[model samples]
Structure formats: structure tokens, C-alpha cells
Target: MPVTPQPLGRRERNKQEKLDRITAAATELFAQYGVDDVTTQQIADKADIGTGTLFLYARNKGELLLLVQNAHYAEALERGRAEAETIPNVLGAVMAIVRPIVECNRVQVDNGRFYLREMVFGDPAEPHHGQALSIVARTEEAIAAALGRHGPIATGDAATTARIISAVMFVTMAASVNASLTTAAILQDIEAQVSLLARR
Candidate 1:
């Protein structure tokens, strides 16, 4: 038998509407002023919700930033994964899976850096933080698949190498020293390191 899902009730619809508004407001404000400069009150005002209501959705500005960046990071990962499928060489394939992520993180450098910090240091109990970690896990899985596909690497080695590559990419992006470097320069550095790592 074909089954139709039940529809959301009034309360659920209202909650979803508020969440959408909150996400949109946070995305715009965070993009304009960066995460550190934007206040929760400002987000609430823009979302047309009370501060308490905003808190109900996201407890603080960091959480709000997670809510905004998680979507973008997920999209970037998918784009990179798709691009990686077309490249044959191991290094080229790995970098294809990395380039969009680096580009996404550099969109607003400060926000990107803070988002990385939050992913590392934020409460795991938080839903958004968990989503961020899931994206990282998915990224590593994609890289490991690429490594395994292009060479005679063992499954365990591929997974371990992928973890190292992910760490390298994230640390390079989040490092204070690389904050001033252009995206191309950072990508070059990552490619160099990845080349050394990908060598069989």
C-alpha cells in the first residue's frame, strides 16, 4: 500500500517558519559583519523574533554561526566529492575533493576560522556542532575512497591517510599564520603537502 506522510500541524509550521527566518537572518548578518561582530540581539531583531525565542533556536552566536555555516560546508563537500569523481591521479583527485572546501572556508576568513574553532571546541551535545563533525567525517570518507581507488593502498592505510590529510587541510586553514594568505597560496601549500602525503 502507498502511504502518505502526515503534514505538520499549526505549531510545527510556525516553529519551522521561525527557524527559517532565524537562519536567513543569521546568514545575512554573519556574512556582512562576520561572526565575531554580530550580536544575538541583532540577529533576533532581524529575524523578527524575541531574544528568548532566538535562544530557543540557538543558544549563542557561535551556535548561530554553526547553524549558518553547516549548510554551506555540506554543500561544498558535495561539490568537491562530485569533482573528485572525474579526476584519475590520486593527488589530483584528493585535491579536487579539497579545493571547494578551502574555497568555502575562505569565503569570510574570520568566520571560517571561528567556525573551525567551534567545531573543535563547541559542545558535542549541540546539534549544529554534531552536524559540523559529521561533515568532516564524510569528507574523510570521500578522501579515503579516492585514495583506495587510485592505488594499491590498504583500506586501513587509506582511512588513516585520509585522516591525516583532513587534519593537514583543517590545521592549515585554521592556523593563525595562514590567516593573511590568499586562497590560492593556501591551496598551493595544501597541494604540496598532499602531494608528499599521497606519494606511494
Candidate 2:
């Protein structure tokens, strides 16, 4: 027989509720006004929590960026996975996996720039650092799965090739946000890179 999942206790439930509220509020405010322009007090007010309570969740704006984007990135990964399944080639498949996230970045490029930077360089001791790692791991898994479905890529494990594809997509996305390149131009560059890897 399958084991039943345990219900969350009151304290755990309350903590999760606060976390959810803060994530929702931050995602909205950051998407609308951009991360650099938003304040912790504004996020607290939006979440209906005291500044002190908000501090318990995120020590500062940088942590808040990771907290907010982690959920969005997870959602993007899921969407990318589904889209990747429908694509015929590994290049298209990988692009499918990255498109949602790249689009999210396109909306508020400044936040995307800072958020990506933080994810890349933030101290591992931070709570959201783990979340970012988990999310990225899932994305890489999605790319590998997509490549598997599309058929064999050139020699080497799909996971390793997927890592290269992910890096390319991320670089393209970062350039789109920070370097003022058009998404189309960045995607074209990504396509050029993918052709060599996927070798269609």
C-alpha cells in the first residue's frame, strides 16, 4: 500500500503561507515596477506582513530577488518542459525549454540581470541559493529529456550536452537583458550555436 503524505503542522503551514504571500507580492511588484525600484517595505506592505516578519523571510532585497524569482523560474521550467516535448529537433527542443524564462527576463531585464547575477555569484549560505540550484538542475533535466525524445545527439551524455545548451541559452538571455541586444538577435545567435551542437 502507498503511504499517505503527512499534513503540515500549524507553524509550518503559517510559515509556508507567509512565504507564498511574499513570493506572490514580490513577483508582481518586481514584474510591474522592476526589482531595482521596489523596496522591502513595499513588499512587506503588499504581503500584509510587518517589515520585521518580512526580514525573517528575506534579510534584504537581494535575497528577496531570489525568493521571488525562484517560484517564477520553477513555473517557467515546467512550461518549457511541456513545450520542448512538441519540438522535433534538439535545438528547437532546448530553445523550447529556455523560451519562457527568456521571455520573463525580457519583461523586466534589469531584475533579470540582477537576479541572474545573484544566482551565479550569491553565497551558497543563502536560502534561495539552494532553490536556484534545484530549479536549474530541473531545467537541465528537462533539456536532456527533450533531447532524448528528439533522438540521439552527437556522442556524450545528454546531460552534459544539455548543460552546454543551457549555458548558451542563458548567455543569450543575459545579453538580451544586460547588453541591450534584441531577443530575436539573441535567439538567432542561439540558433546558430544549436545547429553546431545538435548537428541537423
Best by lDDT: 1
Whole-model lDDT, model 2: 0.82
Q: Give the Cα RMSD of candidate 1.
A: 0.7
lDDT of 1 by residue, 7-117 (tens): 999999999999999999999999999998999999999999999999999899889999999999999999999989999999999999999999999999999999999
TM-score of each: 0.98, 0.85
Q: CA lDDT, every prediction?
A: 0.96, 0.82
**Candidate 2's error at 64, in angstroms?**
1.3
Q: Which stretches of candidate 2 lie over 4 Å from their true place?
A: 1-7, 176-178
